[model samples]
Target chain A: MKQRLSTLMAAAVMTAAFAVQAQQPMKKAPPPAKAAAPAKAKDGITAEFEKFREVLEEDNPAELFEAKGEDIWKHKKGPDGASMAQCDLGLGAGVVKGAYVQMPRYFADVGQVMDAERRIVHCMVKYLGYKEEDIRKQPFSNDSKTPDHVSVITYVAAQSRNMKIAVPQKHPKEIETFRIGREIFDYRAGPYDFSCATCHGSDGMRIRTQDLPNLRKPAEAIRAYQGWPGYRMTGGFMLTQQWRMNDCFRQQRFPEPAYLSDSITALLTYMTATANGQVYKGPGIKR
Target chain B: MTAMKTTILCAATLACGAALAEEVRDYRAEAIAMMKRDFKTRGIATADRVHEDGLQAICNRTSDHPPKAIAERLERDQMESIKYPPDGKLMGDWKAGEKLAQSGRGMTWSDKAGVPGGGNCYNCHQIGPQETSFGTIGPSLYQFGKLRGNTPDVQKYAYGKIYNAKAFNLCSAMPRFGHAGALTESQIKDLVALLLDPQSPVNSK
Candidate 1:
């Protein structure tokens, strides 16, 4: 009788184990079921993009701008007879490599945090002695063949290609700046009452043919953060991060953001830090 | 009898008048003439911009949606115009791609010739989360690789999209970066990495 009881107890224990295993959620979901095969000619959106890729393989006009920017980088300018070579981009003075990947850092000399465009503008004014108005007033070139400051920024950004983004977040100021940036990111206002999160902050969203990235996610943050200072196809110009931000304000119908204002710098720090460890790729091309 | 004859004559006259009004006029020519007469060419915006290419003409005529067969044929023609890298390399540094995506400069009337242009991706896309300010013309690309997976096929798709958006959609609002010579091969490659590289922020943990 005792032996019989032991067998029954063992069976009950085995049943309990099976029930527990069944109740637990699987670590990963099964792969999606295959549906009716799509046409080979219509490989969804992927095939379409492949066609676009083939076209871009030819000569790019941005190369000319990059070449010109290189010249400007090494060229002597300003009343001080100094070149941007002496300018520091948070990686020490005269260092252009990988500087673009990490930006909006704190600088004691500047006494405040600054982004790439603001830093460049400061260098131009303080180091080069170019009038701020002159630099700001110089309109973008009309011709497709001209190079400008935007190109210079692009060239510089390209130098840091493939490097990891490491925007410092250890400083108190950096932390404060990031907090403010977060507020701005989530702040909802404007005619449409739109916030940055309205368009982003979610997954599987799209506008027309383009996909929207969820900025809250680290992977998306890095991919989006690193590709600034790019060449634009619509406006037919190269633009810096500052200009991009400024335009965003305009679209939102908000007052123009002060060029390189602490708000802007803080935003940059927040983005760069959020994107931590992602490879940098800038001086990119955009539609 | 005289009253009926007069009524028939009036009806014939009205038909002839309607036929005359129905004749199609060359509105394009007239518009061109008006533009040439009234519009002044400035520093960089030349009068030639008024002219449309064959594709543009078709798009204009069809209002962005043409017959499927015609669109396919035109797309094929457009594909013919694409230029691949000589070395067949299509990937560049994602770091560089990031900077390019952020910039919005170049090709303004005030700009000089021979300068580079900005991609202005943010004008249409929401790429990075840190950019509190961005546009909504294109879709956001925050976690492209996390959802899509970083495969060679995905990389190729991204490269192509950056190079020529139209190749994928006949009426895509996204500009044809490569088809129009706006972006270099290396630049496109870098952008590819920005979207597809596992180490890229798009795929980061």
Candidate 2:
């Protein structure tokens, strides 16, 4: 009886082994070569992105901000009662057309390089004689309406809408700003210890259903950088470029960035320079 | 003899397991204390933000996998904190919602008290088209209405998720916009319209 029991146990063990072998076949053939090389090949996630892009080709509501911004640009404002027509954006004075596309450039007068947003703030304060605190205090929108800052940025950016990003890098200060911005980009800290590169440096990375553009790549950088001062669907408010940078600092667990601060301008200069050839598409609509 | 050996082995194993569990508990406590000591409260960022609530404590202790019974109970508790709009309307103006999502202002140490805060949604999700400077922390919300349809159930889900993301997923990184008072009911409603309104750009082709 003992021998019979032992034989039965051996048979059971053999059956279990066979079941395991059947369940997990050894060395399954690789997927087709053509299938592997598809544009959405990171993990079959890109297939859905094609549909998203198709939807994005339609009209964006951020066009409204751009239109309003244009109006603000020509309208006389401030205690000086002057328009921003004479303000220089590194492309000569009062040249609205395509000026924004070449910003965050070296400015000899300011003795430093500045981004589009910082330059606008400078013009608003210095040339326009508008109080800096008043502009800063202005709500993103006036009770759900688009704000003046966003309108101005959109209008200015729209002037360079189809132009190539041409941020100047001739000055030594410009170079220094780029280097500092690069360091900040790679620096890691906070509860998650995440760096900007964690999401943006790698190609084909994503979070949930959104595709992360690799900021290191020129095309991606331009595609990513050109759209700012966008209208957001989730909050029902328009945002300025300064607000965008401030939020980025918040997510990084760093101290909140001062609006239109030098550090933020330097970072913007670096990013804009990196995207030197991409078409500008401002005051974008976003979900 | 065999019975006696088995009993001895069982006792030894139980003693070792108990010792290991106690060590782990002590280590966790030390880590929490260290974090509290190092964290500095500034402006809106208070020391209490670092302290875990009961639900968070459970998630931390179990590494996001509390016992099934405990998870269910915690979810129920969290649901109770959600406050619905008094007017019973789940959606408001999409145009207003667009502005709120775009603005990323207020609620920092530097910000003055009584100043309104921004939703900062573009930092994570793609809610609409035309936004060139959006981050990809959350999913693309473009065509949300067209894809999900503007049903009452869908509206409720969107509102609830925005209100307290943790209520749906215990460890969700999405901020509790409504529950935390980061957004008002009217703001949430506008956001809902931005996502679900057929005429909104989100639902447009």
The lDDT for every candidate, in the order shown, is 0.60, 0.65
Q: Write the per-residue lDDT of candidate 2 for residues B74-136, one digit (tens) a residue.
A: 777778888888777899999999888887565555555567677777666767665544555
Specify the CAPRI tier of model 1: incorrect
Q: Which one wins on TM-score?
A: 2
lDDT of 2 by residue, A70-181 (tens): 6777875767677688789887888878888788878899798788877887787776676788876763563356656667777787777667788878787777677566
In terms of docking quality, model 2 is: incorrect
* Alpha-carbon RMSD, each predicted model: 25.3, 24.3
* TM per prediction: 0.48, 0.50
DockQ of each: 0.02, 0.03
Q: Runs in model 1 with CA error above 4 Å?
A: A1-50, A53-60, A138-147, B1-205
Q: Candidate 2: fnat, from 0 to 1?
A: 0.04
Residue B172 miss distance in model 2 (angstroms): 21
- Give the interface RMSD values of the models in order: 17.8, 11.6
Model no. 1, DockQ: 0.02
Chain A TM-score of candidate 2 vs. true chain A: 0.75
**Fnat for candidate 1 (0 to 1):** 0.01
